[model samples]
Target: MRRIGLQLASVLVLLALWAFVAAMRWVDPLYLPGPGAVWDAFVRANSCYPITEGAARKICGESNYYLWEHLVVSLQRIGVGVGLGALAGVVVGYLMGSSRLLMLLVNPYLNFLRALPPLGYIGLLVVWVGIGESSKYWLLFLAAFPPVVIATIQGVASVREDQLLAASSLGAGLRERVMTVILPSSLPYVVQGIRLATGFAWTTVVAAELNNGIPGIGGLAFQSGVQLQTALTIACILVIGLVAVALDQVIVWIGRALVPWQGKEV
Candidate 1:
């Protein structure tokens, strides 16, 4: 409760500072819209719609903004891309961790790819796959895959040799050792990697949406920036942050449920 109070207090302080700055016009409203303006923009984006005529009249309420649609698309892309990337990363990482030769073979390529700026992959993906959903998914996957791989490798490598030896003495085969000892021991690190990958996936949404001019929160932010809709842009940014934080919290909860022994001092 005390920690929660402190967190709320900090947020309140920031909001107060922001309100003061906006009220005093210390910065141009064009660059930083006040909270009220952002709220108005949010309401408009969600509620405002256009009336239509003729046969399309019943369902023809078209608004310049479709916040929900954009949010759904972004979530779908992130979910699928991150899911695939994390699975592949865990598999490859387990293999690399288990085999020094495999690690040696793949490490150089992994390092090379990881060193590149994530957005740099966007152009290459566009050229290879064209501007389509495939390109977006590829970009997101690339954005998320490396960290998970690294984390999984580290996790697996950190497993105690004594545990493995004990399992072996207990008549455990390779598969049993992996299933009971290796996987459970490495799960914490795998979950950490997934958490990091999820952040990457969410951050990559803008670049992914830019590929085909797809309608997502990223597209909305890009359009708002292009049109100089400062309040709307800020609203979109706030929405993105909120969603990312919410998703991350969900991941954290899952981690706690799966690895209840994590963080306990030995």
Candidate 2:
């Protein structure tokens, strides 16, 4: 909590400095709008009005327009991509960790793919899949899958060999040994991967949206900045950060639930 408070205080101080610089014309207000301008834009944006065409367009006055739809669109992409990637990572990681033959055959290819920069594929993906939700999801899945797979592999390999040997000596079959020992021991690493994957998902979602002309938070940010609405652009950036943090917290909560020992340690 202290860390979070300190980080937020630092952000507030930077914002204050920025506002002062712009207000005093040390920085061009057009280039670095004051905090007041940003807040006014944010309020208008949240009110579902958005100050379109440099005039107020409140829901009451203009019937109905809202950020909710855009928010929902972005959330849907995040949900589907993260879900698919995490599932695949866990399964493949388990296989590679437990099966020596599989690991030898797969690790090189996996490493090569992981080494590639994620954003480098945006143009190719757009060309192959077209500018649509499908491409967006594919990009996000690529972003998330590698970390989970690596964590699972490490977790499984890190388990004590003696435990498995003992289980085998007691006439425990492969499935029983895995259930009682491997899965339980490797859970921490797997959870860690999920946490990392959440961050990856956010980056992929924004990049995909921006490059592909998708109508999501990234698109909104791009549109606002292009139209010279610096406040709205900054608000969109804030919204992205908030969403990433929320997703991260949810993952942490799940980790604590699954491994109650963590709570005890805390």
The whole-model lDDT of each prediction reads 0.86, 0.80
- Per TM-score, the best of the predicted structures is 1
Error of 2 at 140 (Å): 0.3
Q: Write the per-residue lDDT of candidate 1 for residues 82-165, one digit (tens) a residue.
A: 999999999999999999999999999999987887687788888999998888888888878899999999999989999999
Over the stretch 34-105, how does candidate 2's per-residue lDDT look in tens digits? 788877876766575435656765352111323445566788887888779999999999999989999999
* Per-prediction TM-score: 0.92, 0.87
Candidate 2: worst 10 consecutive residues by lDDT? 58-67
What is the overall TM-score of model 2 with all chains considered together?
Answer: 0.87
For model 2, what is the alpha-carbon lDDT of residue 188?
A: 87
